[model samples]
Target: MKTAAAAGEAEFYLEPMIVTAARYDNSAGKPGYYKVDEKKLENGNYDNALDVIKQLPGVTLMARGASGGMNAYSKILLNGSDRYLVIIDGVRSNWNGSSYNDFDFSVLPAGMLESVEVLSSAAGSVYGNAAKGGVIRITTKKAVEGVKTSINLETGSYGREQENILHLGKSGEWSWSVYARKSIMGDYSSARQSIPSYENVENAGIKLTKAWGETADLTLSYSVFSGRYKSKIFNYKNTEPDETKPPKLFKNIFMTDARKTEDNLTLEYERKFSDTENNIVGIYRRSSNAAYDRSLNVERPWLLDLRTEGFFDRYSKQWHPKHTLTGGVEYYKDQVLDYQDLAAKYSDGTVISKAVHLQDSWQLADSVKAVGSLRQDWNSYAGSKLSPALSLEY
Candidate 1:
């Protein structure tokens, strides 16, 4: 019998694998990464994406005001820190460059998400300065071989109602997916203050992909979310004569109205040179607008309008027997179009950033693996910095 080497073929055939759990889908696998797939999302019946994100280990959810839902304040703490990067369909979604602002989840439909991956470890080395705490990646559903559609309608206590629709199909060399969702939260009394609040949200997204020869593909996607809320709060007031008798305080109800809208557009191209090599290039733009009206409490209404645009490229190659190398470049510009508050009108300006990163994964032994990454970033406003990270798994 002839030896397999005599056949003049590669020793082992490359088998494609679908990985939705790892930190980098095509890069080295890291520990402490968790993935919530479509099956889990449906079986859990979560109200929103945030609810599903809360179930992950090392993650804590905190909210204020209207139970952290729409029109309220909510944030996620990963590994004891609230600073983290959020990526939706390969596009950055941070309204504020610093990640300290409230992250609105009302627009993310649980039924439309294909998977949510969380890397709880500090990953600045590969994701840049914004990923000090970790990274949260959300992947929307996409068409496969055939067409599929789903509809979800739900009602809950406090007069909450939600509806979601998803349509996905693949025909010839083109694939497409569309999603729409609406949520209405009726007046509900807060547990602490018994304040009544109402909220409504609307969200929609569409993705289209065109493939050529199974080696290259182009994808375009767009998403929009709008949400508004109204709530009444009691303010205390004291009269001159009231100070004489126990300082009688009068309660005044003030109505507050807040609205927010976000939009994202992205275009990406990917080419596969082989099973072990590939490259991706993409461009994206994201914007968010927020307005708050509280005439009774403040003299002027508050508003914030922010927009960001960026480009990114990444290449992955396996050049050695035990090594896989990945390199990437990123450039982004963040601008505050309009900003105003009770104190003053915050200056409107723009901040730009350019960064490059390299990663190496080594299969040290049969049961041992190591991954190391380094990133250099230059920010127009904050100067430059270098970040490095290393991990070993057995």
Candidate 2:
């Protein structure tokens, strides 16, 4: 009786679709080098480059406070040495500019990074003695095919707040990326502080690139960071009013009023002669200035100024199916303009350095490789030296 109603039944089927992402790892070409995974960096939500560096194997970070805090003084020690090097987008960031100051990792925000590469073992041949302890290479974000924008905001205790914005776009052969960030701590109090401190930081940067087909490209990048902080200040009174009381100097503890500004500018050009050959030329400059007033209600001011300029030319060629050769020449000059200290004698000085290096990588077998490098360096103060290294991987 109901057979007419059961005649209309239908079935549908769907197939699965899979998507994959591609990532590049340049560490294979450099002995003793390792790259932090892109997926891990994206998911870690780290605040600054210092946090990521702290998690690497055979790395130790010694600091006074939090890694990126205003009151923090950090020293990156690798394999028990503090002579490591830091590079950002193919530009050297540290070891050439400041005399008494270390590279403050707090200035480098994590949201603007694309990748981080680390060399834990000695890399003296490729990067000179500055990399004796290790090397940290950082690459900033690049523009994609289309327009994109992102924003991040964070809040925490001690009246901490941070905001970051990044925008990227590409049109035809021109692409650019711009970013800005701000971090503030209105009231930071430590166990050793009787009063709260305040800090403010501002950072902004832009990178522009022009590509001529796939064989050549030119890039210009500039970034600046400004930070101001006032440390905990309180008064200590002599309740017993005696000349023998040693002048109650407790107020001088953690009392600081300082501001610092740092900027970096880099220009780079790359051309590919063929699929197996290429070359790069880069010029970079970096500077830092700081002003401090240690005494409250006093106008005494001290200034510290440092500057560095560098130029480099590098070439790469694949001579055979399994052999690759690379060579480079580098020049750098550093100057200290207005640095002064009572305990340490620091005066105006300029240092010039020149270096030449060559490296070869050979494929010994389907799954084995060998690399060798030699470098000669000339310094204005430290004299000249030759460094050689060899490594094998299977």
Candidate 3:
């Protein structure tokens, strides 16, 4: 009863590459973790992290300002909100002073990143409040065994240009890497003939590592980013124009010109005490200063300068053949060095945050695993909270 076409259809099968699932053995104990590696970065032709994130599913991109213009402020939304946390090499980078705990991705240069990891599911139980939606972790390249250097130059339409340089080297027990990048984009006007918008960004970073015996290692890293942009804001009338007539006149309101600079320094130490036990400690400090100048709204120009310092210690132990236990504690302090307007200055009291977390992973069966986590966080501004989670995987 089988015809020729029917017989061929019975033998059809999917390709091996199409059916095989990619494995992630280095996910740092995160579930549903997806990573974009250097090879994928090369293929994506991405100029920044925001560009790369746009290709990922379940991530919504929100923009403010001109449509498709370089001066736009882009934000990422996961789990239907922008509550996700951004971490750079295990250090929280978001500004806690802001009502919404969000980090600006546009200021970071993609050229300095070695990989990007996204945890699609809720990670609040593990990472704390800012991770109620998800978590994005960015890792930078480390020095290799030998010297490696590269320089890249790119140019395109609309007077867009970018330059990047990277250097990595290792000598004796010391390894170091340095990266620098700059990008500039010319003005572009909207359909309303609003004033054109432009953007310029520069970033530099350095990492140093030292091997201390066979069981321990130390790493130090620092990065600085600066950006300036101009954009026009439009105001529209509520009343609708005549149906047969042309669109109503939209008044050009304020023209905003803004500048921001941020810097981060981190030091980390890792030690493998035994085959089944390891410990890590890290300290980091980040500072950001920004100025917003709006024409026509000259009554008040805004300035903000804030600094945050934090440290974390974590320990992992494989107590049983089928069970692993991990615990960590983190402490951070935030200070508003300057918050000023054209008329008066305001002082924001210091904010402190502390957290302790514990997690256990147990293999229940050959294909079944269980995970449980508990975390307590105390923030000067947000109060204290205890979060717990349990999950099973097969």
Highest TM-score among the candidates is held by which one? Answer: 1
Give candidate 2's root-mean-square deviation (CA, Å). 6.2
lDDT of 2 by residue, 282-351 (tens): 9999887776665653334456778889999988999997898888999998887777432234658899
Q: Of the pair 1 and 2, which is ahead by TM-score?
A: 1
Q: Top model by lDDT, which number?
A: 1
Residues 27-62, candidate 1, lDDT per residue (tens digit)?
224355678887778898776777877888777886
lDDT for model 3: 0.74
> Each model's RMSD to truth, in Å?
9.8, 6.2, 9.3
Error of 1 at 207 (Å): 0.5
List the lowest-lDDT window of 10 residues for candidate 3.
64-73
- Prediction-by-prediction clash tally: 0, 0, 0
Cα error of candidate 3 at position 309, Å: 1.1
lDDT of 1: 0.76
lDDT scores for all predictions? 0.76, 0.74, 0.74
By lDDT, the better pick of 1 and 3 is 1
Candidate 2's displacement at residue 331, Å, is: 0.9
Off by over 4 Å in 1: 1-30, 64-73, 99-102, 120-122, 190-194, 231-255, 319-322, 363-369
| 147: Cα error in model 3, Å | 1.1
Sort the candidates on TM-score, descending order. 1, 2, 3
